[model samples]
Target: MMVRLGSSASRYVIATMAALALAACGGGGSSTPTPTPTPTPTPTSSTPVFTSPTTWSVDSGSSGVFYIATATGPAGKTLSFTITGGDDQSFFTVTSSGGLSFKSPPDFGNPQDANKDNVYVVQLTVTDGTTPVNQTVYVTVIKPDADVRVRRVGTGFNQPVYVYPVTDGSGRVYVVERTGRIKILDPKASNPAATTTLLDVSAEISTDGERGLLGFTLSPNFATDRTFYVFLTNASGAIEIRKYKTLASNNDQADTSTADVIMQIPHPRNAHYGGWIGFGADNYLYITTGDGGSPSDSDGNAQNKSSLLGKVLRIDPATDSFPNDANKDYAIPTGNPYATSGGAPEVIAYGFRNPKRASFEFATGLLIGDQGENSWEEADLLLPSDYGTAGTAPNFGWPILEGTHSFVGGDTTGLIPPILEYAHGTGGQQGSAIIGGYVYRGAVTSLQLNYYFGDAATGNVWSVPTQSIARGSTIKAENFRLRNGGFTPDVGTINNVVSFGQDNAANLYIVDADGDIFIVEKKPTA
Candidate 1:
């Protein structure tokens, strides 16, 4: 359609024509041109993730490849792995190939983790060119299923009470029989059944109840002196300590004419004869005695500093202190607790109740198995400072306190409690009699430096960390059979374990009341 222009339209057309004429002729004012803008590149998205599990189980005492880190990242993007944080990160070391391992082998018994638990935690980081990922890893250290078993070394004795290895470089062991016979047998022989009688005093000693040829030990100078000692009950029912000499011509026979009574204590009752004798590293004779054999120690023998019936008596058997008394031959050690004044000159420490078994641990300290009356059985430890003039002799709570529990009526003041104790019953934590064992310094790595003890009534063996005990930690005993259940097929339950013995190499043996001896061994892993 055609339209007519108004007056304002006519003016706009004239101005547009005049501006076009000036630009064509290059007659406009100074002008500026607009610059072009830079374009933004497209961003590439990346997601880094760990394909491995966050939880892992690492075998104790194993060193390599506990975990292998597997991860995924964006295609053609470089990926890296690193350990970033956590309490146990110092224990772990990672490889560029994603293999993770411990800096050293982890021990289950004494964990090196920050929390002292077997569980270890660590933070892991994986990074790509575009994205970074972090993961918290939890590694649980598991104990090795060690295979431990006992191999029978000998049998056919009359209630063998102890097996003492001969220190004369003979490789023979002296087996003590409760029927008043001490037999020498070669455990490594092709026929271990052949035993030679070293001493037989069945006619001179009484063997009625808890009495017999109970304890024996070779002198530390036996190789040169050819001397040994024995503990037994005399015809009058008193505990007798005697000394004898071996024949110069025969190592297996004791010279009957050389037998002499060293000392005798009046033990009227028919039970609780302590009778455990051994030579300490100081070469002094150490003898253990019971509290004169009455329930709850009614005679008050253990607490009486003047009485020798319930004390650990240390003496120098080479010299005589009681020269006037023919029976009292031994001289008290110089550093004995009572050697100067308060109690019997031979008494080193007091307060013991039926410490039937005792041993020195790796030439360091004394370990005693004190049988409780009604409720508990305990293991007592005497450190280096607790004996021999250190003036720290601990009064092991006997009548006053039985295994950390206060008994009927006695002063509990200044009493040193037992380091380990168990209740009375047939369960895991209970046993009638506690047979204390030696601190294992043997070839078995799993049982290294552990104090092995057991119950005589149940024949269940247990162990505690000796290092922890030395550090003054009262730790719970671990059941040996339950903890190392991977025993060999031929191994079975040990019945009536009366005592434990050790050879010169520190190899441990279990002595059965039914006349069997077993050597504890650990089968090698394949």
Candidate 2:
């Protein structure tokens, strides 16, 4: 601009000067504009996260070693779990690897507490690196669908074997101890404590195996007359069914003067007395008899229709005399199976090995349970319509057929089969014996309804949904068979699962051989 030269020449001179100035200022910094500062990006963190499920389900009659699946965090994470709250926490157990198991099945150890619902809350916590997470799972326990609750109500007796409960409309329960003593418990009372010595027949009753006061029942009109009956094996080894009148209302003992012999079945052997008595829906008393003790019906009395041994006898106690006066100690009902078959009039149903217990379902009038013998313990469901009817004979093949299978050197044809049959051994593991139970029909709960019956040897209470038990049906039995339905500690170990009886209100009562009585009621846990 100072030189004022021609346009092109002056422009060239100015450009040269500018280039020189940029080179002096570190390759065009001051003259071309200052360079902007470069910025650095910040890094993000790398931590893992975790989550877990919130609920689970336990099958009915499931116990011990409850395993659960969990959601874990990234590769190297750890988990810790605990049962935060529940009723019967002591009844459960947990493992380090997130496994939850019961010490015993819920209803096995202790009777479900009616006052509280059964519930369990399990909490699980997981950690990944420094990140932590937690989850809570809820578990609910329930009773088996069957209404019967077998429990050990009394203890401290020498070799206590059988227990029978006679209940009043009120919540009073009278239990018969095999030692020939009656114990009473007032369930309605504050403490529901047990009282002793209501009646003691230890002197007259035999305390040997399968003997003593094995059966007891209240008169159909027990409320008004306070009359009751007991079937006992005497010390002299005779089975007697005696009638008694209760002095104290709802008391279990006979008013000394009221000891009248209703009937007696001559028991030749110490074993196989077959002493169980109950009033049928027809109001006739039904008595069960054994095979006259020994194996293979050696006494010949079991197959003899004229004799009561190994037979179901129906009789009227209203007008019965002692000995055989054509019709004294007991009168045969016209509806007896052999009344017109040219056999003994008192024979209701024949071909039983040793019928230990018989119960009448209140709703459907069915006589069921307990056929004892060499290889099989059976449960039979007898229909009222099938009573004394031709073409309806129940064979219960004893010496001939052990269970459903025919054995060598025994009759195989024309034998009635059992509704439910099981082999017996120690605590019912191998082949031992069968203990029968009642058909539950109560108002308290609706878990196990319409099942045919319950078994004692296996400690497995089961049922068939059908109203009447048919031949060769898939009967469902329940127990804690952990691995492939094989052996387990819970097998055949149901304590106090002795006899099944009912009260005035039709509530089922379970008595233990330990002499304890437990009234079955619905105990729901959420």
Candidate 3:
């Protein structure tokens, strides 16, 4: 190869040639700009990359697993995940693979330091080999007792059939036993320490099938008048509606001598002694009785106008105007459905085979649970003539049209169809017999304002939108399936739910024939 040399001078040219020849062989010049160096692209690690964090909550004593997105890259780089900034670090943890989970369940019942409810917060950091993205997460710890339970408020009640909490500021829940004794329960006590017999007519009433002291209620003027009412059957199977005065000295005791016999009607035969009574929103006394003590009503008592047997009788016990009042103790309200010529002035609605229970909501006339003979158990909604009036009308179709269909070959000419009816069966059966329940104006948010009634035989409780009925909507009372409002497991077992009653606070209580009282509260899981 020919050498090209740069000469400092002609004499130095020769030496330069030799140096240039050496440089060509791999020696470099100290001042020459060897072909401007090509610029390499930045390594791609400087840009920030990662997804935003999200928030979450979980019940205390429960495990929770959360997810995160796969991180982006800083060129050929992989991402790393981490967690930071959390209190009570023992309760939660995060894995390097972006999984957030509870290390241990948080106990809201026994909070670590504060009596107040707790919320756990933690930050998740996701890095893409270059920059990190931080997100905030919140986990809530819920109370252990927050989930409503069929809390036994009173136990060993000896056939507690009814629970009536008087609005007298006493916080006493009166439990009526089938053997005819009214027991008292303290609001502050769970199992009754000892049943204080508020009233003992145990020796007076018949406790045969569906007989005995069935149900009772406190007078609207109970606080001042100290009066309460009870429905019972005498030894002769005669239904008696009576009022007794509470002892001034003790809220749990009543004056036996103060018994004011409101009505005493002979219940013939002895099977369906329609045994339930309560004051309506109108403050008027409404009584429900069977079409006599027979199952078939072959005696035609349910359709007879003169008979109070199969009728819903409305009377103002204060006015004492009942046409058949033995003591002139109760006055008939101005507008009785059959006050003119149907059968009796005391008959508000006609044709009930064996109405186990009936209740009146000021907004929606009346809901009568008519126990069917064979096929249909009905919940009849009687609408008032003057939709203007609160609870007014409806002629229930008794033996003739048992639940929208013919039972004893009776015509439906004037029979009001049942708003709801369910056939008899065990699984989802409305139950063999229908026991009327109250419209829930209870404290449970999920079950609030819904009408809850159960079967005396099946313990199956069902609800219908009372508001829907109030609007007079076409929502017929067909046996609607039981709904726990998305709350878990069936409402425990009511064990022959004899009745449903509410405390002064509108907290609903279940009266089980098994001698226990259950209060329904808000379910935490809801």
lDDT of each: 0.75, 0.55, 0.66
Q: Which segments of candidate 2 are over 4 A away from where they belong?
A: 1-167, 188-193, 248-253, 321-327, 362-365, 389-393, 408-411, 425-431, 444-446, 450-458, 466-468, 471-493, 524-526
Q: How do the predictions measure up, each by TM-score?
A: 0.70, 0.64, 0.66
Model 2 lowest lDDT segment of ten: 1-10
Q: Clashing pairs in model 1?
A: none
Question: Candidate 1 lDDT (Cα, whole model)?
Answer: 0.75
Q: Residue 264 of candidate 1: its Cα lDDT?
A: 88
Q: How close is candidate 3 to the true structure, as a TM-score?
A: 0.66
Better by TM-score, candidate 3 or 2:
3
lDDT of 3 by residue, 269-310 (tens): 667877778887678787888887675787888878788898
What is candidate 2's lDDT per residue for 1-526, written digit by digit as tens?
1111112211111111221233443454357666676776654323323233354434345644434434554545555555544444555555544556666655423445333455556555444446645555555554444433333333444433344444545556566667787666554454434465566778888767678877777788777777777788877778888888878643655686778776766687777766677787677887888877776777777666677787777788866534655214666676676666656777766666777777665423344454556555666655444454842444556656655755434666556566666554332122245556555455644523444233454343333433334443313222211111111112123343556655656555555454344555544444
Candidate 1's TM-score: 0.70
Ranking by TM-score: 1, 3, 2
The CA-based lDDT of model 3 is what?
0.66
Q: Say which candidate scores most in lDDT.
A: 1
Over the stretch 347-432, how does candidate 1's per-residue lDDT look in tens digits? 77788888888998645567888888998888777654555563445588788888878886577766766778876766434578
